[model samples]
Target: MGEACERPGSTEDCVDDAVCATDASETGDPADPVWETYTCRAVCVDESDCPEGQECRGVTGAFATRACQPLR
Candidate 1:
């Protein structure tokens, strides 16, 4: 299984595309939200793929995973 980087500051060094966004859960479960790893993933760029109130965004300036997150 891929390493889980749920924390904000956590970053994957040396990765070619190590950018990820947070996928928030409604239940507020303790388990971390799934981190979608990607290489120029569509969900990262296409806001249309994101659920309501969430938008596709990058993480840590890296391009590892693109995930859905609430507007900031």
Candidate 2:
């Protein structure tokens, strides 16, 4: 549930029930996919919707996606 949406190329909008978020690190040469910073996390309703050892939690940023993240 960490992939992007249904588009042909870059600059895609999140599909229904998904949100765009960033989690990037510096690359020696940043040019396109060499250093991608955006991710699509699934919006979960509760723990039941998550896999084992994970729980539905709000995404790190101000986004509305509630992804199933591993316990802290």
Candidate 3:
């Protein structure tokens, strides 16, 4: 299988594929400062590993995607 096809259990296990730059603001202006981007891999191992107000949602290649939602 190809290297990209391999999956990691967690973000710590992910190898950076690219160093993308993201604007610091929502305006999407190029003049804005750039932020480093990490490969979209599992950022957390479990729900408890997520932030206090966020939940982990599974992504295609990532173990989970951290999303914030109101408590039910």
Among residues 3 or more apart in sequence or in different chains, the pairs in candidate 1 whose N, CA or C atoms overlap within 3 Å are: 17-63, 17-64, 18-63, 18-64, 19-62, 19-63, 19-64, 19-65, 20-65
TM-score, structure 2 vs. true: 0.46
lDDT of 3 by residue, 8-28 (tens): 333333345311111133345
Better model by TM-score, 1 or 3? 1
Q: Which candidate gets the maximum TM-score versus the true structure?
A: 2
lDDT of 2 by residue, 1-72 (tens): 466533312224665666554443465544442424666655678999877887777765544457665554
For model 3, where is the 10-residue window of minimal lDDT? 17-26
Question: Cα lDDT for residue 43, model 1?
Answer: 35
Pairs with backbone N, CA or C atoms under 3 Å apart (clashes), candidate 3 = none
Poorest lDDT segment (10 consecutive residues) of candidate 2: 4-13
Strongest candidate by lDDT: 2
Clashes of each: 9, 0, 0
RMSD from true fold, candidate 2: 7.2
Model 2, 4: alpha-carbon shift in Å? 5.6
Indicate the worst ten consecutive residues by lDDT in candidate 1. 35-44
In candidate 2, which residue pairs get closer than 3 Å at backbone N, Cα or C atoms, i.e. clash?
A: none
